[model samples]
Target: MSINKFIKASIQEEDQEPSAPSPQAESFSDFDRAYHSMLCAGCSCLCDDISYYMKEGHVTRTLNLCEVGWKRLCAVSAEDRVPPPSPSLLSDTVNQAARLLQAHPPVLVLGADNADEAAIRTSFELAGTFRGISLPWAYPGIRRFYERAKRFGWATGLLDEVRDRAESVIFWRADPLVTHHRHLSRYSLFARGRLTERGNLDRNLAAVASHETVIEPLCQQFFQLSTDQDSALIEALAHPGGGGGLDHRDLPALARALQGSSYVALFVDPEKVTYEALDAMFRWSAKLNTEGRKRMVILPLWDAGPNIEGFCRVSLEKNATPWGGPFAKASAGTQPEDTSWEDLAGTVGSVILISSGVDASPGNVLPKGLSEKPRVVIDPFKRTPALKDQVVIPTALPGLESDGIFFRADGLPFDVHGIEVWRNHGYPTVRDVLADLMSEGR
Candidate 1:
């Protein structure tokens, strides 16, 4: 089959059962709220101020959740095919997985950015035991910013701090209007901070993107610049008086506003940005701190799978850097080589994929041979595995079915409480499966 057709079929199969639209709040006056305060796991923000109404053990309506998140919460009643585990069969499966790990000298363990810390760490232990390479599934788009912050400590804090203290918020190559639906209303423009009680009236909002977004109306200044011109804009900001452009007479004024702000926060999105552009942003933030005596905090608008932050945190502690496969070290006897995604197929003998309720398909980056390898997939949903001869183990959803700790985009740990209603359902968590695998090896 063609790749396009396969992708289309996979998507169609994934969304086999569309959820029913939820009613308005006015229609639910008499319905008692069961899960009144809930945490949303849809986006990386992990918005915790959710009001969920339950009818007969299933979530019916959610208040204060964004449209995307509301739909995820409403999917609790979908015909999710989760089977009860049979001990004999599960043991046989785990033994088969363990044997695969033992046989494949340097297996590449991937995915689990959306899993809890426990699961992420357990997978690491499993890999370490077998001397295999473990890597994050999602690439860290804000790695440059993260590295800069760690190397040269930046004056930064959590989302609440940004909402309360920042006087000027600049979106550099970022469109929170799409990635984070409630970013403007909940944290920046419409949110009345402690000092800026007048909300957007008391703050300056600036954006630099290729095209306009829904949040353009709230922007104090919008610079419609091409991707190739990001460095030029940064250069102009660095030297505002140079007037390096023939168009947009307001560039100097915007630069002045950024320089003059008492407290400024820069929200960067690197989805379309290059490394040079990242370097310019780092330099821009550094210059702002050095020259003005006021520090500018750079926040990213990128969201990863649930526990990518946790994986990064652990990776930083152990490896002094956070990255996805294929990572390699200096020598064979030394740590494994810090590998890139492009180098995986040429190196590894086998692959162990963890689906984590998201995309389970092998990405196009994998070589055809590795892509065709018989593998193991751990996921909550019961969709067909991308590989033909793959072992599919059903697990429980993190926030809805299982309780664990997950970090927000800014690295703040949020506690997730699993529904007690799902405890008796006999579904396993990523941690459970990994732990059992590790235990089997011992």
Candidate 2:
């Protein structure tokens, strides 16, 4: 069958499903209700094709949204996802984020994976310029993989690109349906890409699942692994030669399955795959390339707040180091004398927290480097109160209340627009705050 006919048939299948027209919003004049691009960062699908139906003021109906997106758009409240943070509590945090690092810039800047990448880069350049630390964020693992990417090459392409170019997709410890609902529909499977032409040709998709999942049902091939079996697979993949300096035969099925592709796409969840496991997975991808696959691409899955991709790029520039760079290292930013948050709070003079999506309480902490001093926070929300000298300056929510370029897990650009559904004591961006702090010289 022709590629065009195959694509048409796919469309026909979608057309058969019940559908509704998007609400006509030609009359609403409210700024918040105005037409804006709706891209939910709640998950990795990073679905960019969202539109909203405005009622009195806020979104009454978010068109084409999935469950996660629907939950975010809807006012369904949860303890962890909806606790209103107080600036006062955060205001009471240690001032080390500013003061200690002010004397000698920090080297390692971790946690860029949690926030928007553009802002993170601002933080990175600040670190690098100040000679602050940047490396291995959140944990000690994954640095080698990052270093490898930096050395061999780190190529970034978007989900849209995958839909357009990918012929074979291999999901390693990744379930886009769970992690990113509608990904298969909007971007991967049901998506209409330019190359989807050759009919169901050799366009293969495979997934590794804990149980029969939404992914397993849809993939052309499935690898079911118990926790133990999964670990064994990782071990086998990592060693290739199976620990005893010989290739193990247990992975023959996986090896043979992988053999049947020209171009392949590999996706893995960073949280699930350890460094060694990830190394093995990459080795397999590399092997596929040498074995005559036309192309090879890898997509790393990361879980964080939002816009982690933009922050990574920004952090890399500011710190001369990537996000997850070392925060304890002197080269990243050294504050050896700075007291820990536990020791400095209440006793130390005051505090400041330049943060977003953080708990605003005494226990709600900053890094050891930032918690020792008294300071102020440049925030974008209203949260809990402080224990001592505290001030919470509200800021805007990236992509929601503010406009910027956000990045995906694969480090591709995602243009964002505002979507303010609630009250926020908005403050300036972190970059602006740093500029102000320097200008004031306080």
Candidate 3:
């Protein structure tokens, strides 16, 4: 297919720091099938128009897939997708997986933004099983927004809602086109939606981000921003002049646009927005008194890790934390600090890795130094950076192999699974394996 078609069919994905094997020669055989339309929620692109080609639990070819999607599909394994099956000790591996939870009191499970729903559920099950903290590693900009949202319960809508009914859509620190590929085609620029049957110049797309980006022709306005989801505008709003800070040259224009917008929708990843900025937005939204023509919606451009939201919902419903891993919430005295993989070095005990998605091989996130302790990997591809594990359990990639639902960036529910593969129930979901491990009671 042409690159444009491939791009359209692509699923936008964030960078997964792990290293893994190259696409397999025998990855897809004769038995697998292809799936279309379903999107991967690993990133904000939320490209729903995607296609996958698979063969017998493996992906052979892909259409309309992004780099991340192709990598994710290619990473699937049909057979026992685990580590090297070390020492003939399944029991020990299981025990270690559970014990890691038990020992790491108030475990803070991170990096679930790119994971599928099944994996997310498994993580939550583990958390509940162990009672730990599970925080989905979404964009840091939205942290303030999420925090305020948890308290005041802000209003929200979907991408389509903005494209259809909203007069304005503010994409803060995010580019859906480059990352999402089909977002413009499906919802924003050239596409059609509920109120916009013949989408052309009906809705406005405002990009507030760092660096010069490509959607030049379609955007109504552009605001140069920091790559690190900055909230200088909010600070400016609070302290308009007592100011000795960054200059927001076009901020006045942005605020004017918002004030003039009859129906406004802010599409942002809460991780990028600051507490003050988000609070200001919230206050502004409340004052707008959205009733009919003057409506506002705030869509948190969320990206689910394997099971981040799924696990979070389950954790809340079940009142359980994700893992017993070290976290600030559960720890009595010590707090879990954000340490890069480089700093983790030799402190890591037995490693239990689950190559969650197509983003990258989890090895990149592991410390460069070896732990010497036995390693356990859960994935289908035998060759990858996570390859050093003493045991390899080939686990099936969930979306194509099994069926389940995952939430979108706006917390709206969507299905992640499709008939992309032809698989018998022999290969179980990661949740089942973790469930068995948790059952053994570490």
lDDT top scorer? 1
TM-scores for candidates 1 onward, in order: 0.82, 0.64, 0.70
* Model 1's TM-score against the true structure: 0.82
- Candidate 1: tens digits of C-alpha lDDT, residues 186-231: 6766578898787766778888888876556556678888888888
Candidate 2 regions exceeding 4 Å error are 1-37, 41-45, 70-118, 125-142, 150-157, 197-204, 209-257, 318-320, 324-393, 419-427, 430-442
Q: Which candidate is the best by TM-score?
A: 1
- Angstrom error of the Cα, residue 191, model 3: value is 2.5
lDDT at 25, model 3: 41
RMSD values, in order shown: 7.2, 8.0, 7.1
lDDT of 2 at 335: 28
Report residue 67 deviation for candidate 3 (angstroms): 4.0
Residues 1-442 of candidate 3 have per-residue lDDT tens digits of: 5533443433232121123233454354443676777766444455676655555555545555555555555455423244334344655666665655455443334443434565655665555555544445442333344457666667776666766776567776656655555556665555676776756455566777667866544466676766433555644433444332556566666556665667777766555555656776676566554444477777655433544445445544544332223343344444223333333323333444565455445566444553344444555444555444345445545665566676655456677664533345345555556566558644
Worst lDDT window (10 residues) for model 1? 329-338
After superposition, the stretches of candidate 1 with alpha carbons farther than 4 Å from their true spots are 1-33, 138-143, 150-152, 210-218, 224-226, 243-250, 324-326, 329-340, 356-370
Q: Rank the candidates by lDDT, best first.
A: 1, 3, 2
